[model samples]
Target: MHGPGSSGWLLVTLCAATGAYCLLRMRSSVEEQRRAAAGEALMGFGMAAMAVPTAVFTPPAWAWPLWAAVFGAAGVHGLWAARASARHLHHVVGAGAMVYMAVVMAAGPRAAHHSTTAGIPALTAALLLYFTAYVLVTGARLVPVPAVAGGPGSTGPRTGPGAGWGDRPELARACRLSMGIAMVAMLLTM
Candidate 1:
């Protein structure tokens, strides 16, 4: 079977690694954080699968509706999650977009991708824009900000991770930025 090229495989690797990290984060001490990590892990894996080169493994006929239903359910859950914490709105939008992309690729008139068309191109443009912005914003956040001293809200600078792999929140944010970059590249190839 045909397979992904070097760049495609690189994106796949990045996404898969992100998913793995998120899964590991599920073991965090905090229950709420664990739940959020679980959701992110699922999204990471799903996006990795979606990024796979179509030539390698075209999504099966049943995959369209199946993924639609799955993402739709995730979207609903994301909405509820957002109600509790506005941060989850991104998750809701991401899930909904996954469902939309799945449908467009599977059932649109230009499904074969024989020619430039409206559906996939438009969707890709939107995703690219969103992910490009996500990458930039998250990348900026990765920069260390010095904490204020003696300030009411200041916790002071965080000490480096000691024995563990890395800080969970920071790692998660890095993963998100990585995936955002990967998605932008993958979508461009469409």
Candidate 2:
């Protein structure tokens, strides 16, 4: 087991890793809603891990430009989905949080690694805390997915619980649960 010296950091890593596993499981599920939820959770994990290294440790000057481009791409792409997922509170909030994280990290992400500077570390700490809360709260929301009831004649998906594998509602719930646990763990660490 990884030592406990950096429990906080370890939790952060664990959440990210577990989130990834859940995503993979989601994909393999015999359900479509599960697939979509897995996919969305993967995106959430990506956003959370984007600037983690920068948040936890200082990097060489060369790292800035590289990270800048990476975070910039993530922010821009997340914005692209921002409009469509606007109706989705989880998506909206999560995407917005990612943008905010990108901005904070880009502003000067290596302070904690360098000379004493409370501002950067303070900001990082605050951002981590906020996002952690966001992940926990948002993950609780229930998204509806359609499920196919009966037989092939009624192959279409229907709402409500008991939706079988490959159904929309089933997929939706799985996505939420998976994302929720991952985010909650992440937030707790922060």
Candidate 3:
């Protein structure tokens, strides 16, 4: 990201750590979680790589198109997976956003800087709004909500003593939230 030295490094650290956690989540006994974790891990790592400060290491011109191609395949995979569960739709959007950023950076100097532009592209603004809402909704879900007594569909917290590290839904939600925040930051830089 085009941030100050410290902030850019912070984003890098945050994303890398998130990617590591997602890798651990892949050990989940649940097949579904294992699958989801694989995709999230890709997003986390990709964001980390892209967020590296330009001054420290600007990728070669060819790297941008290669980046776009990788994410394009990821988006396609996400689209196919979404058929099984709607949750995978988020992955599709995430991959698409990464592709968009890669393409913009490859377009030329002016598009890459973005600040020289008169206004944000409608697509970028739309992506920002989507990610912002995603972050808010995911964060809200993380809050502990009290269970009402004798409520029709009331189920207390889902945590269980036997649940493995990879099986914890809260941690997964947290992982998603972090990625959403990272996406927003990346878009702002674009």
State how far residue 18 of model 3 sits from its true place (Å). Answer: 0.5
Candidate 2 similarity to native, TM-score: 0.43
Candidate 1 structure quality by residue, lDDT tens digits, 1-190: 1135666666777878888998888876667777777877887888778777766777787887888888999999999988889998888877877787677667743552533455455656777788789889999999987666876638643555432343456777887787677666756655
lDDT of 2 by residue, 13-99 (tens): 655654665565564435544534554655556534542543455546565455445545544555665566643445544444444
Per-residue lDDT value at 45 in model 3? 93
lDDT of each: 0.73, 0.48, 0.89
Question: After superposition on all CA atoms, how large is the RMSD of candidate 1?
Answer: 3.9
Q: Using lDDT, give the best candidate's number.
A: 3
TM-score of each: 0.80, 0.43, 0.90
Q: Which candidate gets the maximum TM-score versus the true structure?
A: 3
**In terms of TM-score, how similar is model 1 to the real structure?**
0.80
> Per TM-score, what order, best first?
3, 1, 2
Clashing pairs in 2: 31-166, 33-171, 34-171, 145-168, 145-169, 146-168, 146-169, 147-157, 147-158
